[model samples]
Target: MHQLNSLEKRAAIALALVFSTRMLGLFMLLPVFALYGEQLVGFSPLWIGLAIGAYGLTQAILQIPFGWLSDKIGRHKVMLLGLSLFVLGSVVAALAESVYMVTLGRVLQGAGAIAGAVLALAADLTREEQRPKVMAIIGASIGLSFAVAMVAGPLLARWAGLSGVFWFTAVLAVCAMLIVAFLVPKSVSKAPMAETLALPQSLAAMLKHGQLLRLDAGVLILHLMLTAMFVALPALLNQQHLAAERHWQVYLPVLLGSFLFMVPMMIIAMRRQQEKRYFLINVLLLVIAMLICWQATTLWGLVLALLVFFIGFNFLEASLPAMVSRVAPAGQRGSAMGIYSSSQFFGAFLGGLLGGAVAQQFGFVAIFAVLAGIGLVWLAIASTMQVPSRAQRLSLPVAVTTEQQAAALAAKLAALAGVQEVTILLADQRCYLKVSAQQFELAQAQSLVAVGNQ
Candidate 1:
């Protein structure tokens, strides 16, 4: 196991805090926004749904550009700018008295678009062996923030109303800014690593990759179902005579149950190297949740349905990025992640749009049917996904003077024990490899080329 250095530890902690804080701000609105927006001027179900998902649209648009800008400027500078935009958007939403303005505020909020930049920075600050652990910590933090926000959103709205939530997020954004400026140390580049920054030119090839495409589509459909479900769920609960303020009581216990179910499955998957089987089962769980919702008659049945839904949601959220990292071609991981993130946000937008429209025209039951259909589509796609190799990403520095030399060296490494794939960057004196954990001999690999994790 690679130990985290002092800087890596500090960076991971600070970055995770920043990420969780930002996500909490975003998610804290999901459960309560629909109810409170009815009091605003020009409010309607469709606009409320659009308001809920508007942030995703802007986020999808700017994620790549912000990351590219971070590469040009410094990471902290870009992060600060993103945070500033987030705070401004929060304030706008806080002051708005109309649904259209709220939609504008949500769009502004999405414009921060810092997820790619944050992940890139995390990659820059950690070693290859330690990167997965660090990323996992950050990913877990984001997931926890979502869980917390789901509970907190309703409770806070009950006490302070919708505007209060926006004000609170603005405060959180300010704290995030302080952390970015003071607590987080500057990242020092170790070597030119492909996974750390987006490469626009590589997008075409990554899109064509069957395995990567499956993961991308999976994330898209997953989030689409999530946002769409929430668009109609609150109303369904209201129809069942559950007060809006009491929704948290239902969300809290179900979220906990989902977490309990999710953690064990993730552990078993990792321990036994059963990524494909676990993924397939989780997708089926989601399908079952949708089916349960389709027939739900009581609040308790709905609770059980959400429990199953989140179990699948949380599992896929945790595993999908790891899958993307493993399957993406070397030197293109960042671009691949950018696309993945964009797809996720875009799905949120489409879900809100489509879900709200469906709910308005038909009923919440129709929304459930639509989401169930989506789950079935995802099941088909996920079934065809390639199982990720049980290898960690490792970077090796080689002494190659020519393109031909680098190519020859990469071929040599490919035949070595434990090596599954290799991509040599002729311009960078570096080679990226996927090596089997049980079979990879780091010492032998280093003998051929001066090995270092990029």
Candidate 2:
């Protein structure tokens, strides 16, 4: 029931716009790129796939470094630099006459890697209790952006061709930069919190966490299937006698109907506390959808398959990150998310590489079969994942100056009723805790910390 204040609202809205615009630019190419990629020099299924996924490779590689860099220079500065790179890449891609140049542009675009910095700034601008709400807004924007891009990509391509789409993406990136410059509120706290910023020291432990790894693998496979599916889906529709320009007609209704179906499933899962059950079911749904896509001969048949696919895809996309937050250790959520995001981007790269290769060697239908197999494997791995506890994390400023004081304070906080975990960072003068949402008392925690400071 915690409400976001005025400043929090402004920050959340601005940051969400910035995040979504960049994502919109990135995604606009997914649906239309394969069809138009043939017009470029050195056009081939393999190169086309590589061009589609090249950005992900750089994004996965540089995102963590850019985040660490943000801590040194400042969040706003890093964001500006990142957005600038995105614009430059878009422009490069727009002007390219060859697949190689477009691939280079996509790689440059990925190098922006501003996701972590943006989230960190969000954390700095909002209170701990209000952070989840802000994150939800941003998450919702991403999903909405993806849905919009799927429809818009084909329409834009019909009007302007492939280069036109890239030009529009460049324009969107520039607008995002302007938003970052003027609309997004600056973070008041410069001190990085482990709950918000990735710590290099914690990376190994997060990598080793079995549960967190499952979620990471899940996102990787999810995006992999998504990108790989797109590698052939547009062409599949085109083969069904649907013109490229008319592709939006199919996407529009299918996405709308799928969203309607997905909402009820999400509601039921949450209300019934059957998230794990629903999660597995959704995975199974993806497998079934892929199999149908592989076999469908008619346009409507493919549409039906896509409808089923999106229902599962949308639900899993929303729920997986929530699972990561729940499974991550109290202070290491940032590190866990960092890894999860990298896995996601890397999966995109793999999808393009593998999908293109498969299409070249085995043809389009084989792509879906491969994806279905991957989904089955993922479902098996995910079956072992334990249900995460309903623990909420809180980070509070502490006044302890010495390690001894910090340790003593951490022990006291750990011993509090309903507190599941406590991590005190002396350097940051902050304490992070994971506690049962229903049983934890924030007032008591604040009082105890205040006394410890005194």
Candidate 3:
């Protein structure tokens, strides 16, 4: 409940704006691209789907490496390079006359992966306690961008055409670059933050954990189902007599209604500690959406199905990061998140390939069947997940000159009352602890670390 100071608020808003700006440009094509892609030479259902998801393939491949590069170079410098690449990709897409060219442009767009760097920068700018709020702000911005893109992308494409959409994206990328240079506050500390960069050594542990793996798989499948569904959705709407230009009419209501339903369910799940239950419910809802798509005879029924799907999508979108944080070991959150993001993007790429192939051979409706099968598998995996822990992680800066000193301090802190886990990272000059808030004595722990600071 602590309020963010002016600096924290500024960093959060500026980062959120940067994130939203880039995502808005990317998502703006989701609702209309499949339809508009038809106008390209060498266009087919398969290539159209590839054009929609090719960005994810390169994004997944480069996401971690880009963040690692940011650590060696300055964050702002990395961001500048990434944004420049993005602008170049947008220009390529704008000039593309064939689906193959569009796919290549999308691949280049994904090559500029900078999400990890942006997150690292946010972590550096905020205190440990305030980082969650900053992440939440950034997360909300992404969700808002998706909703707005669904509506605005179609509208913009209606007037300007698909190429015009890419031109606008290039303009937005330039604006984001300016914001990075001027609006973002510089990090004052050179401390190595576990929340900012992933450690390669931690990769095995992060991947092997049962809970974290499940969550990671869930995200990958969630995005896979989403991208795959969209591959056919635009065409289906055509069957229902809704033109691509008018698609927003359905999306606007679906997003609004889904948000209204999603918020309450999230609150209830948190209050009742029924995260697993609600997560399973959402998975099932996705399955139901697929089934409805498979059998629906009316447009209104399809709209209703979309509402259900969004309700589940929105809830999971909000909760998945929280789930990851809860299960991740102290001091290795960045690694966990990086792996999770890779999985999610990979899902998008695979979904496009799978959906496109199925649509081309079996027909549009069969894509729904394929997605439903995937949903059921996800539901089975999710059902095995335990309820997420409510304990909070606290980071304490400590001075330690040797590995032995750090170990001794870690042992001492581990023996403290209410401390569930301790991780002392000497290189970072910090120790991370997980504890129940009600039982934790922050004053005493702060006193212990304060001596080191002095």
Candidate 4:
């Protein structure tokens, strides 16, 4: 197995911290906002839910634009600008006296939209072969951050109230900025590739891809249920006589226990090559969890429901992105991911809106009932998704000085047995290929490229 070099390691750690800190700032608000938000002027279930999800709306809109801008100017500059907006938004929320002001602050925070830039920068800093590991590290950090935020949010709220939480978020944003400015290794300036950067022209084709669209909708619905659940979960806990500060006691155990169950399922699915099977099972698990939440009458009952929910949530969260990578057309992964991410953020926005509306009209428990229905719809759609074949992506450096040469090389590579897709970039001096895992012969491909170069 290949290993990341010292520089790759440093870049991975620093960027992971940056990603985690920003995510933590966002997630901390998820668990505590409902309970403490009531203290603000103009507080209502609708406004509180909107405030919670308001950042997602802007994040959905601007993530791609920020990514494209980073390609135009530079990654570091765009990241700094995004982090600055985040810090400013956090401060605004910290000082807000009304829920609407807090919502405005959240919107500003979303406007920062650094996720795409961060990924692009990571792509710049690592080798193609090592990129998956780097991304896994970053993804793991986001998950860890969420677990920590769930526990820490309530504790912080107990100590400093909601404003204090926002203040802490602002501090985190500053730390991320510092990481971007000083810690992350500088990347070589190059033209962004369709593999790593979103190309606007490719958007429509990705939208029309049935498998990609299904994955996109899956993420959207998953996040929608998540944000909507929080809209009422805190209040439900409070009603069950659990104090706000003590909510962490429940979150810590449930999260930990859920991982215990989730990891085994993940391993089994991978080992058996039964991802679609497990995927459907996890989706069904979510539905069951929501139904449990609807009927739970005691604290323990709700805890059990949450345990089930997280077990499914964590697995799906990790799996969906991987599926998107596998299902995406060769050379167009960037555009597919851009659309998928936007859908996720938009889902969060909708979750807040719809979750709040349902909770306001029908009460908190009703939100779960609605979510369960949505899960069924997703389950039905997902049932028809084709299992992604085992495919390996290989990036090979080729000596080609002209567009015609590059085109000739691409055509030759595409003719190789087991090659599923091929993309050649003349400026990058590389050919990107997706090939069958079992049938692709590295030696054969290398020999062909060598002969062509000679």
State which candidate, 1 or 2, has the greater lDDT. 2
lDDT tens digits, residues 121-147, model 2?
998898777889998999899998998
Tens digits of lDDT, candidate 3, 1-454: 2499888898899889888989898888778888888899998878867988888998899998899998888788888898888888999999999888888888888888999889988888887778889989999999999999999988989899999999999998999999999999987764355766778888888888988999999999999888888899988888899988899999999999999999999999889988889889999999998999888888998898899999999999888888888888888888889998998899889888888889889988899988999999999999898864688888877888888878877877777788888888877788888888888898878877776556
Candidate-wise lDDT, in order:
0.86, 0.91, 0.87, 0.92
lDDT of 1: 0.86
lDDT of 1 by residue, 1-454 (tens): 2489988899899999999999999998889887877899988778867988899999989998998898889789999999999999999999999988888988998999988778888888887768877888898899889989988898889899999999999999999999999998888783354676667777788889898889999998998888888888888888889998899999999999998999999999989989899999999888899889889999988998999999999999889988888888766677788899999999889888888898889877788888888888888998888876666778877677777777767877888888988888766667888888899888888877753321
C-alpha RMSD values across all candidates: 2.3, 1.6, 1.7, 1.9
TM-score of 3: 0.96
Q: Which has the higher TM-score value, candidate number 1 or candidate number 2? A: 2
Model 1 TM-score on a 0 to 1 scale: 0.95
Query: Which portions of model 3 miss their true places by more than 4 Å?
Result: 447-454
lDDT of 4 by residue, 1-454 (tens): 1489998899899999999999999999999999998889999999878999999999999989999999989899999999999999999999999999999999999999999989999999888778889989999999999999999999999999999999999999999999998998889854246777788888999999999999999999999999999999999999999999999999999999999999999999999999999999999999999999999999999999999999999999999999999888777888999999999999999999999999889888999999999999999999999977878888777888888878888888888888998877665667778999788888888987887677
Q: Using Cα atoms with residue i matched to residue i, what is each candidate's TM-score against the true structure?
A: 0.95, 0.97, 0.96, 0.96
Total residue pair clashes for candidate 3:
0
